[model samples]
Target: MATPVSGLCSLKNKVALVTGASSGIGADVARLFASYGCRLALTGRNMEALQQVTDKCVERGLDKDEILMIQADFEVESDVRKTAEQTIQKFNQIDVLINNAGVYLNDSVENVILENFDRVFVVNVRAPLLLTHLLAPYLIKTKGTVVNVSSIVGRVSMRGLLTYSMSKSAMDHMTRCIADGLCFD
Candidate 1:
């Protein structure tokens, strides 16, 4: 017989890797996942905020050892790679990958520059792609899911957030392609 669902959001014992988890939606999700008994590898640019979130998870009944917090600058290739490596090293399995890390460049298309544009895309678009690539094998083994957090700006033209919007659009497309590519019988 099929098992009955528990609580409102139960992800018990599942290993989840959440990016941009220091403060914001990522942090909230991590807390929720923890409350539901998920093992987590959470990455963000701020160590302090990450620790605070970790503490909150503990307060929600998770053991301190159940969470791994990594300080990462998503725009840096080495940091992105390290985030994936460390997560796999800790959990040895990843059931959920939440791609919520993003960088916002407040520049219109007219004012956008190559340097700023590169930074935004590297953090908002490329890092998640690299993480998914590194984690795909584990995800496939578990038949897991990937959640890419994006903005409405991706679907609409935002005058001052041209680069950010474009980057999220790229992220949305990348998610779709990965989802399609990872489909298995």
Candidate 2:
């Protein structure tokens, strides 16, 4: 019986923190991780959506207790911190950090403003950095991995996604730096 999302790595019983887990890629990742038997800590701004995702995980055989749902908005730095604290409080150890939360503004340099740019950066770049920082100790101890969900927009410029593109580019760099800094061998 082969599963849909095959894995070269073993994920059974591992703990994963997936941001933006209410929808899109985040929700899909949560479902896949649950299928692999990874304990899940999912964060998103919408509880109703989060619960729907949770239901899918439950359908995948994760006990309701095996999953922790956090209603968080990455625009708030404190929410980012609280996400880490809450996940750690529940799971004690985190084996995977999925920085998938993000905000996108359809604006070009011509119309871009600090408020919108900051919102994009805070969620796309800063949230991942802060979560990695807060969970560094546990990640180090467990030799865990960080998956920053970045888009091609980061590398290829688009007219209406000026701020989003820049933030994702920064995210690309952040992922590389984190991988290097966390190298144990």
Candidate 3:
């Protein structure tokens, strides 16, 4: 069943930025947002998959220009900054920022190398932090929302995912801090 008008009203005509939108949860959110008449800026490492998602959004009634696809690798700092700038450049305003780009490394502390741990943290935690910082001004101007996608592992211990769990825990904390800060701002 569809959500009632009151529930859906706020999303219509809003501009949303969704990372990791080439597939999975990010793509699904982008599609739903587009269906609600939201303009979207999508980013991911896979251009082909991102294009497919954009096509689906277009089919859902969004014009080609209403959707912007940026291919960005979260591990690269320059790419992360560029993604935010490009989104703002295209849309002029951002009403929603979904920090959903992440990496999962399945290895215990005993086997995980420093390189793997660093890569996971960079993608899962640092990138989101940087993106949020870069877009804070625009988001504040519009009183926009920021949705940080976290994992259950952050709350509960999981085997073979030490780095992943830690990164998610950091994200959860970051969300709380940002929310509190926003309340004051």
Candidate 4:
């Protein structure tokens, strides 16, 4: 049986980079991809947590040389760029890029501070944009794909999440704009 997204049974020759891979959806996606034989570059702020995920991948039969774990805080543009550089250095090219690092707060506008707003935008919006920009040429070279995890909050506004919603809205628009601007043959 073949994988759902691609017809091939394995991604043996492909390389992928997954951000926020310490846990949750990112971790799951990385595991799934690894099972398909995709070499991975996984990133998260917590080194220990990222190592755990990598360990799981190793247990699943991925070779030690096939996984690269990068400790990064996506809020920092420098870190995001360095991640892209390191991944390229490790894999030579990235066949897929997953921007999955994100944060959420239950607090409403009244309780949300300016710092909170900045952190949300920096991680959820700016960081992804910068990373995408840095790695676009390589993606184009490989005819690769970028999957960004966006929230429904961007389209539906609810109380207490004003800033988060705004950031997601911006992220959605940015995604579309990048897709339109980049022409893939």
Using lDDT, give the best candidate's number. 3
Model 1 lDDT, residue 79, Cα? 93
Model-by-model lDDT, in order?
0.88, 0.91, 0.92, 0.88
Predicted candidate 3 versus true structure: per-residue lDDT over 112-173, tens digit per residue: 88999999999999999999999999999998999999999999989999999999999999
| Consecutive 10-residue window with the lowest summed lDDT within model 3 | 1-10
Backbone collisions counted per model: 0, 0, 0, 1
TM-score of each: 0.94, 0.96, 0.95, 0.92
Q: lDDT by residue for model 1 over 38-154, one digit each (tens)?
A: 899999889999999999999887898989999999989999999999998998999899999988879986787999999999999889999999988899898888999999998
Candidates arranged by TM-score, highest first: 2, 3, 1, 4
Stretches of candidate 4 exceeding 4 Å from the true structure: 1-10
Overall local distance difference test of candidate 2: 0.91
Arranged by lDDT, best first: 3, 2, 1, 4
What tens digits encode model 2's per-residue C-alpha lDDT throughout 1-185? 12755462388899999999999999999998998888999999999999999999999879999999999999999999999999999999999999999998899878889899988888899889999999999988888888999999999988899999999999999988878778743
Off by over 4 Å in 2: 1-9
Q: Could you tell me the lDDT of residue 150 within candidate 3?
A: 98
TM-score of 3: 0.95
Residue 148 lDDT in candidate 4: 88
lDDT assessment of candidate 3: 0.92
